[model samples]
Target: MSAYEFPALAIQDWLRVFCYDSYCADAMTSGLTNSKDTVLRWQLAVDTLYRLIASDLLHIPTLKADDLSAQKAAALDYIKSLAHHNPFSSDIEETSHWYLWDISATDRCHRLIEAYGIRDIPQGELSQGLVAALHNLFAENRVAWSDQPLIAVSADS
Candidate 1:
C-alpha cells in the first residue's frame, strides 16, 4: 500500500478495535462509576482524532514544498476546525464540546500536522510517525479521562 493508503487503513483498523469492539468498551469503563458517560467521552476522543487525521490527509496535497507558512496554516486549520461547535446546552453536548476543546489546545496534534506537511520525509517514516502520534494521542486522552472523578455525583443529594 502507498503511504496514504497505509495510514487510512491503519486508522480504520484502530477505530474498529477501540470504538466498535466490545472488549475496548468493557476495558474503558471497567472501574468507573459513570460507565456510560466514560464510554461516551472515550468515543468522542477517538472520533475527534480520526477527524483530525482525515483532515490532515486532505491537506497533504495542497502543502507546498519548503513553505513553512503553508505547513503552519494547515496545522492551525486542523486546530481551528476541531474547535468549532454549536453552543452546547445539554450535558452530553457540553462534554463533547469541552473534550474537543481540550484536544485542540494540545501542541502534539499541531506538531503532527506540521510534520506531515514536510516534503522530504520518506513514505515509510511518515507512516510510522503518523501511527505513533495517533497512538500517543489516544493514550494521552485516556490518561486525562482517568484523572477525572470516576463517580458521578448527583446534584439533588
Candidate 2:
C-alpha cells in the first residue's frame, strides 16, 4: 500500500466507529454546552491527537484519560527531540523554517480532519466523543508508530 493508503483506511475505520458507536453518537448530539469556544478547544485537542498519530509520533492501544495524557506527553517529548536538531545555524532561518513547517503541518492536519467528516460534527458533543472513538480505534487497530517509509505492494501480492 502507498503511504497514504493505510492511514486513510485506518482513519475511515475510526470515523465509522465514532459515528456509529452509541456513546459517541450521544455525545455528538447531547447539547452539553452552547459555548463555541469550548467546542473549538475540544476540536483542537482532537486535531492535535490525530496529528500526532498521523505523524507517527504517538502509539497506544487506547485513549483512556490516563493513557492519552501519558502518550501525549511522550509525543511532545519526541517533538522536542526533533527540534533539538535544528538544521540551520542561523536563528532567524531556523525560526522561519519552523513556522513554515508548522503552517504546512496544520494545513495537512485540517485537510485530513475535514476529509474524514470529523469537521462536520456538532460542536457541543465533540468533547464527549473525542476519547471514545480514539479509544475504539486504538483498541481495534493497536496502531504502531514508525518512522520507516511505507512500501508499495504489488497487486498480485
Candidate 3:
C-alpha cells in the first residue's frame, strides 16, 4: 500500500513503540527493526522510523518506482493543517510517536469547536478514567502490549 494510504498515526506508533520514555530509547527487541548505523541503538531505531517517513517514495527496491510525491504531499499537507492549530509540528522525518501527534490534533480540534459545561462530576477524574479505559483498549488491540494502572493523586481534594 502507498504510505499515503496508511494512517499517519499507525506509522508514528511504529516509529516509537516506547512512546517517549527515554528509557526505551535503545530497546529494540529481536523482532524490532533498525536501519541506522550511527549512534546508540535507540537513536538508530528512531532514525530507521524516520527513514520510513519523509521518503519521496517508499523504496522497497523490489517494487517499481511509483512517484507518490503528490499523495505524500497531500497527506502531509493535511497533517500540517492539523498541526497548524496545535503545539506539535510535523518534521521532515520523525523517529517518534505519530499516534500522539494525530490524537493531539484531533483533541485540539475538539477543544476548539466544543464547549463544555461546568458539572458536579470532576472532569479530572472523568478524564483519568477515560485514559485508563483507552489504555486497556490499546493493550487489548495491539498484538503485544501491556500497561499498569495509572494512578493520579491530587492535593486539591
**In terms of TM-score, which candidate is strongest?**
2
For each candidate, the alpha-carbon lDDT, in order, equals 0.36, 0.35, 0.28
RMSD of each: 13.6, 17.8, 17.6
Q: Give the per-residue lDDT digits (tens) of candidate 2, residues 122-154.
A: 432343343444445444544332333222111
Tell me how many clashing residue pairs each candidate has: 0, 0, 2
Which portions of model 2 miss their true places by more than 4 Å? 1-51, 54-81, 85-90, 100-117, 124-127, 136-157
Q: Which window of ten consecutive residues has the lowest lDDT sum in model 2? A: 22-31
All candidates: TM-score: 0.24, 0.25, 0.19
**Candidate 1 error regions (>4 Å):** 1-108, 118-126, 143-157
Strongest candidate by lDDT: 1
Output the lDDT of residue 1, model 3.
23
Candidate 2 contains a number of clashing pairs equal to 0
Q: How close is candidate 2 to the true structure, as a TM-score?
A: 0.25
In model 3, the runs with Cα more than 4 Å from the true position are 1-13, 16-52, 56-67, 87-157
lDDT of 3 at 58: 19
Which residue pairs show backbone clashes in model 3? Answer: 12-98, 25-42
Q: Model 2 residue 116 lDDT?
A: 43
Which candidate, 1 or 3, has the higher TM-score?
Answer: 1
Candidate order by lDDT, highest to lowest?
1, 2, 3
